[model samples]
Target: MTPNALLLAHDKPAALRPDQLRQFQELGYLVLPGFLDRDLVARMRHEVDRWVDDGLRARSIDSVKDPEKFGVPPVMELELPAHGELITWSPLLEILDQLVGAPYAFHHLHSDRQAPDIPGKPWHHDYEHSTQTDRSATMIHALHYLDGLSTDTSSLVVLPGSHRERVDKTARAHLGTEPLPGEVVLEELPPGSTVVLHSALFHARRPRPGVLGKPRYFVDASYCEVGPLWPPVKPYWRYMLRRARELNLAPDRSELFTELTFAEYSRPA
Candidate 1:
C-alpha cells in the first residue's frame, strides 16, 4: 500500500472524530502524522542524545535490571523539559482521552536514540496486566518518532487487530520482525509523528539492511485507563509518579500521576 494510504489509519481531524475512534477501537492502533511540534521534536532529540551519551540511559536500565541495587536513576525521561512537555502535550492527551473513554494514568516513559546498527527486535506486545486476561481496559503507548522515519531508519511493523487476541506478550517472539500477513510497515512518517498503539498490539522494530541507518530518535510513553489496577514495570514507579507530580507535568490530569492506578509492584519470577 502507498504511504498515504497506510497513514489513513487515523483521520486527520483537529479533534478525534467518531470514525477515527471507531478505527482505533477495531484496529488497536492509530497513526497521527506530524502529531508533535517540530521545535519540541528538536529538543527531544537533544535530550535523547544526552540520555544516551551521559550514561543516564545505562543507569536507568540498571535500575530496572537490579532495582535493589540501583533504586532509581538520578533522572527519569519525563524530568527533561521537552520530554515532560511531550508527555502532557495537549493534542496527544486529547486523542488518548477519546480512545480510553475514561481517566487514564501515566504508565511509563522511555527515550532512546537507537544506534544505526540496531538489530530487529522480536515481535512482542507490551501490555502489563498481572494475569494477562481480558483486553477490556485500554493501555496505549504513544510512540514518538522525533526525527521521523525513512528508508534509512528502522521501521515499525505491527500486526493489525492482534490486540483483540488474548495471548502472552511474547507469543509471536519466534516469528521475529519479518513481514507477516496483514502486517503494516510504517516507514514513511514525517518528523514529529506519533503512532499510538494499544499496548497489547503485537509489533516489532525491523532495522534496514545494507543501507547505513541513521540514529533514530524515538520515545514512547504509555497510559492505562482507570479501571483495574495495572502492573508497574518499574520498581521505582512510585518515585517516578511523585517526580512527575512535583514537576507538575499534568496539573489537570489528576489521574495521571496518582498511585491508585497501579497495584503493588511484584518482582518478576
Candidate 2:
C-alpha cells in the first residue's frame, strides 16, 4: 500500500508535542504509525535487493571501510539512490528538536539487516558505543522497511524505557548472548516509518522468518549537538545536518554518510 506524500502528518513527524514528548521521556519510545510515505519505502526496498545481490550502491560501502566492521557485507539501504530526498527531513527534524531541545549534529548514516535465523545486532546503545559525549537530546533513527516488517521476522527490538538506565561502561560479547531476563518488544512497523530515540537507549535489530530468502532493510541514523565536527568528519556532513534542510537519501548528496573508521562510525559497526 503506497502512502501519499501529502498524507505525512505532524503527529508522526519528529516534531513532538507536550504529550508526545512526555510519552518518549517516560516510555523511551513511541510509535508514530502511517507517518512515512509508502512509495518511497518501496523504492528503498528495491534498492536493498539490488545491493544485497551485488555489493555496491551509489552511497553505501561494499568493502570493509573499518576493520572493526569487517566480515560484514554492507550492500543495503539503496533508498539513497532511489528516493531523492525529504524521506527523513520532515518528521525527523521536528521530533529531534523536541527531544534534543537544541540543534543536533549528524553522527553518520549506516544500514543493518538480519536474515531469518541469523543472529541480530549486538544489544547496545549507539552513543555509548560511539564513545562520544553527545549533547543532542535526541538521536534520529529513521528506518525504511524496504520490505514490510512483521512480528515473527524478529524485526527491530527495543527496550522502551531502557534509555533511562545508566551504563557508562558496557561489555562486548564475542558471540550473541540471550537478551537479559525480561520482556522484549520489537518496534514492528510498515515501510517508510521512522523511529527517533535518545542515544542513551538500548536498541537492537533481529531476524525474522521471511518468505524464505527475503531479509529486512533499515537505516541507522544518529544525531547530536552541532559543534566541532567529530574526527574524520566530512565537509558536506556539516551543511546537510541542519534542522531546516530536508533529510533525503539522495545518492547525489555526499555525507548521506561518509566512510569512517570504527572511531569514525559508531562503535560495534
TM-scores of the models, in the order given: 0.95, 0.65
Please report the candidate that would top lDDT against the real structure: 1
Candidate 2 residue-wise lDDT, 177-203, digit = tens: 345544255445565666556666666
What lDDT score is found at residue 114 in candidate 1? 93
Clashes per model (N, Cα, C within 3 A): 0, 14
Whole-model lDDT per candidate? 0.86, 0.50
Candidate 1 residue pairs that clash: none
Q: After superposition, how far is residue 48 of candidate 1 from its true place, in Å?
A: 0.8
Which candidate should be chosen as best, given TM-score against the real structure?
Answer: 1
Candidate 1 stretches greater than 4 Å from native: 1-13
Q: What's model 2's TM-score?
A: 0.65
